[model samples]
Target: MANGFEAAMRMMRSRDPQRAEDGFGLLRDRAAEYLPALIEEFENEQADRGLRSWLLELIGLAESAEALPVLAAQLNSQDEMLRDWAVAGLTRLDTREARTALWRARANGTIA
Candidate 1:
């Protein structure tokens, strides 16, 4: 689909920090509207490593329980940064699933 979402996605991936910031803001402002697409982008195998944590932060900012699984999955990522953002996301979500994942991560010694 050639929706403006693709354009926003490009901006979010821009080399220019400001463009990426603006795009992230757009996604955050419309988190409910853009979450499904954002989640799809998050799952893209070719997704940039630099932006993966950023996207995770934005998803955390969305504070949607539907994001619990995605955030929880990141808790097990080798990237400690992703684990931190996932913790923040799970905290924001505060759902049972999110909480359980947080506990599991802590128990597994991933997060202190």
Candidate 2:
């Protein structure tokens, strides 16, 4: 993870709404640089559902190609909102693999 990212993660994880909100903005601003760190956080199973969802949203906003795999994986998630965020990220990426995954997910019942 890059410098300041850990702090941003802490802010994102903060229970206080204000801190979390600010952290989300910071994550969006550093979306590209924070891609790997955010992906790592998303991969952690210890997070509650809400935090996982927030991380997904952050990754989508980052719009990094590296996140395609992660977003594609989320297409199969049972959580509809998670799937939506994955689709959103894939669309933002607009790469061949990401677009193909989006199409496949849409056709295969992953994306609604």
Candidate 3:
């Protein structure tokens, strides 16, 4: 399972956007199993920008409120791009906690 998850992530980092989207799409269906890896990749400075963006979109698709804390921590990332993506992902969550966290991050300028 781990190997498969890693392969999916590698695909998501591929140069082809279609491949990346497909990889992320597969992970979305198994979000509970992939959330940790997704969060890890999102926080990895070495990860591709496109892959990170796609991961954020996947988080939104997963609607896993469990990802909220990790996403919130990203709100404090030094990279503005990461912070922005984190904010965007948070909005996808329908929970009140997600909304509250997003509002706070926005008010504090973590996101535009």
Model 1 stretches astray by more than 4 angstroms: 45-47
Ranking by lDDT: 2, 1, 3
Model 1 C-alpha lDDT per residue in residues 16-104, reported as the tens digit of each score: 99999887776777776677777878888355887888778878888887788899898889988888989998998888888888898
lDDT of 2 by residue, 6-111 (tens): 8887887889989988888878877888788888999984547877888998898887788988999999998888998888888888999998998898898767
- Candidate 1 Cα deviation (angstroms), residue 40: 0.8
User: For residues 4-110, what per-residue lDDT tens digits would candidate 3 score against the true structure?
Assistant: 89888877777788887788777978876677777777667354666666676566556687788877777887877767767777777758998888788779876
Q: How does model 1 score by TM-score?
A: 0.89
Each model's TM-score, in the order given? 0.89, 0.91, 0.72
lDDT of each: 0.82, 0.85, 0.75
Best by lDDT: 2
* Candidate 1 positional error at 48, Å: 1.9
Clashing pairs in 1: none
Worst 10 residues of 3 by lDDT: 45-54
